[model samples]
Target chain A: MSLDQNDIAKLARLARIRIEPESVADLQQRLGDILNMVDTMQAVDTTGVDPMANPYDAFQRLRADEVTETDQREKFQAIAPSTEDGLYLVPKVID
Target chain B: MPSYTVAEILQKLESRECSSEEITQSYLDAIAKQDGTINSYITVTAEQALAQARAADELRAKGDAPALCGLPIAHKDIFCTDGIRTSCASKMLDNFIAPYNATVVEKLAAAGVVTLGKTNLDEFAMGSSNETSFYGPVRNPWDINCVPGGSSGGSAAAVAAGLAPIATGTDTGGSIRQPAALCGLTGLKPSYGRVSRYGMIAFASSLDQGGPIARTAEDAAIMMQAMAGFDLRDSTSMDVPVPDYRAALNNDIKGKKIGVPKEYFSAGLHPDIAAAVQTALAEYQKLGAELVEISLPHTELAVPCYYVIAPAEASTNLSRYDGVRYGYRCEDPQDLDDLYTRTREEGFGEEVKRRIMVGTYALSAGFYDAYYRKAQQIRRLIRNDFVEAFKQVDFIAGPTAPNPAFALGEKANDPVTMYLEDIYTISVNLAGLPAISLPAGFSNGKPVSLQLIGRDFDEAGLLAAAHQYQQISDWHRQIAPHAV
Candidate 1:
């Protein structure tokens, strides 16, 4: 149930959140404590229990394919950090 | 006007004893005068609120305004408000202006309620204490040094401090109820799917439910009347008909069976809180409700299960906050990875980042079954315990929180201790039931609350019982000295 420095680094990479090298040990300790708390669930006998994902156990509702939203590109894009020609601007991915 | 309950305020408006503009102005004045030390509001839309209040007055003068017309309320910043900042008390969305109104805001507006402004909350609604807020911790109105439990802390504090008559709050793992308890107000977390979550920012999808925080259950019921219902925009919103919450407020609870779970009164519960809960139960007994001892044996695992499920969901839900679209973006990025990592790293707070990392690890390859799946399976068992208990009892009653509000920064460094602050209230969320936290009494000068959990979609019954309690008890009437 304990997380090491390496595990913390791996989790940070997977979650796409950078952790400063100095904070890694602190994160490892805290995350390890949280995991220890979560480890209590291991004592329970959930062998035959179905994992309850939703409170109501309801399935995702489906509607017929139809255009429901109006194009608000201009309105929506106005709030973006960087945009050009009605598209969000980000670093170039191409070689 | 600041001292009046929502019901009293509505009555005054109905009788023309006051104008909506006058009421709204008084509250705004109070906020300006009192909120500096309390720190409840994140954004106060004074100009917009007055304009809306004047329009409400104009409509009322014409004689066809909605029931709650002209009443002012605060929204927890987690709910999006078009043209207003919806920070969720995090730097991530601090600059993000919601392009459209949340369904809750829309519904309340349609009911003629004026928006006082957006209130503060724990960052991304992730923590038990409001201290996690990037803006700063919300000070408890009862004791300025203490926290008003969170992530709905600001809303609770606003109402308790008489800055607003009522406020909207979301309870994922006791956000609304815990703060209500600590701040001496009534807060309800309607059953899962009872309230639409359309534009209310998500923390844990399955458990997040928006409800009202008011000084009394009658006020909460009035607010809930406008809040609860079906919405097509939210797929999880129930298709059930919205009941007349106000009409059901006075229904007799004389023969109601209130289940008192032994697990709730464990050694960890403070003596003052336990005594207050017992005193409240005695009052319920005086009103002829029977207290039946019940057991929710899996109660011990609720916090553990919730920590896993909530963080797991948060990790996925927060993935949308990349640097591209809206919200906080990093200074410079060499590549796409840098853009994503640096944006999130700089945007989120410590607790939020911790949760994301924990969630990522839980949902990661090879560990999914051991952590996420196991937590979900235990979640089922925990829910089953409630289901069985409810079969024998009409409702469940206990302390809203283990103790009263702790001083700010006391538990900030220790996440687990803060997580345990919600131990008593999280199980209700796990079971997806409606529950209300009403001011029971004061514990060591801090407010204590008694929580009542009801069957799914039984908000009317829960509110009625809480309303009945408020009728005879004057605990809810005790105002914070700072507020006074």
Candidate 2:
């Protein structure tokens, strides 16, 4: 029921959050407190209970596959960090 | 002017006793004088309000005005309002002006409701208290030092303080109802897909629902009429027909079977809250209703289940803000990864970051089955508990929170403690049931709210019970401290 500082750093990396190096200790302590609270669920016996993956189990009522939306790439990409030729420019994955 | 319902206001417009411009101006003046102390509205749309009021008046002249024409309403900052800064109470969207209107906002506008302004809330609707908001905390009108429960605190405060007649609020967990109770208002969260989520900013997709925070259940019903509908844009939007919510608000609950869940009255419940709830239950019994004792054995599992599922969904939903699209951008970045990380780190609040990390960890490769899948199973058990109890009772009753509003800084430091404050109310969201918190009574000087939860899409029955209670009691009529 403990969260190590290293685990906190790893979590931060995965979440893409910039946690200050000094706050790692605080984050560890806080995460420990939270995990301990969640541990309260262990008292409830959930044997043979079906998992509720979604509150809505029904199939999504989708419209027929159609281009209902007009292409707004030029307008939307105007605000992107980096874009060229209607594409977002992330770092070269193959490189 | 102080206690006019939406129906009554519409009547006044027909009689020409009041024009839409006059109604809108009076509300603007009231908001100006009252919102200074309450800090409810983050942005007030004065120009748009005046213009819209003028338009509603013109429509009325032609005798073609909508039922809600000229009615001033507060929109949560989370909804995208065209040409308006829909900040979502986060630094990320502070400078981001919404290019288009959210479907709900557009529908409300189409109904001729005047846009009063954008109300403040927790950053990205992440926390229970409005303290986590980047704009600043919205003060509780009852006790300035105590927190107005959130992330719908602003909307609740506005309605309670008479800043706006009614306001739109989105609840992921107890966001709307808990705050409504704390602020002494009637707020309802319809079934999971009752209200369209097309324009609503995503938190936990399954749990989050936008509904009304109003002075009375009748008002909430009127507002819900315009809000609840199917939208092709939102895939999760229900295909079921939205009933006449106002028509079901009959002040009759004879032979009603009310359930008092034993699990809700267990440890950690404040004595004052218990007394208030008992009194409300007593009132229901007097109205020819029978009180039935029910048990939701898996109640304890709700908090943990909600924490896991909500954050897991939130982690995925919130990933869209990567500094690649519209929102906050860092001044300089060494690489693409650096750009995404620093911008998000700077934009989101502490609580938001904590949830994203927790969600990411729970949903990660190695821990997915252990944490996410396990939590999902517990969620089903918790819901089954409700279904089992509903068979014996028409509705389940409980304190919205264990106690009245807490001091501003009390639960802010510990996120777990703050999350538990919503323990009693979170289960309804998890179960996708329509639940409403009525102004049951008061504890000491502060108000207490008793949450009435019903079967999925049973908002009519819930509102009927709430409206019936309000008819015999003046709790809903009680005004905010300063507003009075």
Candidate 3:
């Protein structure tokens, strides 16, 4: 159940988060401990059981497609972290 | 007027006994005086509450008011409320203003419930103690030094302190129930899809559910009545007809079969909590409830299955917050990779990051089958255990938390013990059944709660059983002793 630094870093990448290098030893131990805690699932016998993906038990009703909310682009973009010319500006995705 | 449940408040507003502004101001004043020490609210929307209250009053004046008109409620920070800061207690979302109300928020507002404010919770609803909140941990009103059980700690604390008549809370694990128990209030987690999840910030979406926290089982029932309904926007929203929850409040539970999970009574259970559960069972016996000793052999596996399933889902659900769309973004990023990395690193808290790591690892390309899929298969097993137990009983009762309020930081470093804190409550979520927590009695001077879980979409039975217990006992009315 022990998590090495490399594994911890990989986990960070998965979560899309960053942990300080100094915080890794602690995170590793803690993650290992958490894995140990969640390890109880290993003992359960799930024979003949289907994974219950959702609690709902109905088919979705399709509706005629229609626009709902009227355009409020100005109001919507008012809260954007950064905006320019009605488009959200961000770091370049392509070089 | 101030102490009425959400139902009673609406009734009064409809009958013209009090204006919505008066009710809103009274609750706001109560919070202003009391919430300083409790630290329950992260954002107090006095202006919005008044505005909504005024609107509700106008509707009432015209005699065309909605059912929950003018009733104020606290929203969990996890829900995306329009124009309001919807930080899921993570630095990453601290600056993120929701472009729209969470579907639940929109629905509640449509019903005319006034917005009191947003309540505090574990940062991204990750930890058992509210200590992980970047905003700061909320204190248990009962004992300030004692930590309020989280991640819905603030919602529980607010209701307990009489800050709001009721507040909405989300439970990923036992977040709502455990806090309700520790804070001496009532909290319900409806069947997973019974309430819409459209705008709720995902945290183990399979396990995450939004419900009500209130001072009494009756109040919780009233709030749940409005909050539970079908929604087209939420793909997981149940198409089942919403029931008249208030009418079912007085339903007979005589001769009802109540299951006591033997595994829940095993070791690690605090002696004090054990006594409270025993007493609660005795009261249920007085109400003609037949207690059956049942076994959920896979009870221990719930934590693991949940961690695996929740994180896997959380991993996917949370992927949307990649500093790319709407929330926090890193400044002056060297490249896309750096932008994603720096933005995330700077935004999420330690616990949120840890879960992302675990979820990411489990759901990774190479390990998906062994970790994610296998865990899901086992989730079925954990649920089957409930199915087998429920076959012999209509509902199950157990200790909500192994012990009452623990000191802050007691288990902060020990995530295993912390996860185990949810042992009794997690299984219900895994099985997608409705569960409720109510104050059973006091143990070791701290309040304890009895957890009652029912079949899918069976909140009425859960509330009936909980309300039945509350009727015979005054535990729910007991206030935490030392407060500010």
Per-candidate TM vs. native?
0.99, 0.97, 0.94
> Each model's DockQ?
0.89, 0.60, 0.58
Looking at model 2, residue B279 earns an lDDT score of 91
Instruction: Please report the candidate that would top lDDT against the real structure.
Output: 1
* Stretch of 10 with least lDDT, candidate 2 chain B: B1-10
State which candidate, 1 or 2, has the greater lDDT. Answer: 1
> How accurately is candidate 2 docked according to DockQ?
0.60
lDDT of 3 by residue, B365-440 (tens): 8877667877878777777788788788999998998988999889887777788889888888888889999998
Q: After superposition, how far is residue B37 of candidate 2 from its true place, in Å?
A: 2.0
Per-residue C-alpha lDDT of model 1 across residues B103-202, encoded as one tens digit per residue: 9999999999999999989999988778888889899988999999998999999998999999999999999999999999999999999899999999
- Stretches off by above 4 angstroms in model 3 are A43-49, A55-75, A93-95, B1-4, B7-17, B482-484
The order of the candidates by lDDT, greatest first, is 1, 2, 3
Please name the candidate that would achieve the greatest DockQ relative to the true structure. Answer: 1
TM-score ranking, high to low? 1, 2, 3
Please list all clashing residue pairs in model 1, or write none if there are none. none
Order the candidates by DockQ, highest first — what do you get?
1, 2, 3
Q: What's the CA error at residue B11 for candidate 3, in Å?
A: 5.3
DockQ, structure candidate 3: 0.58
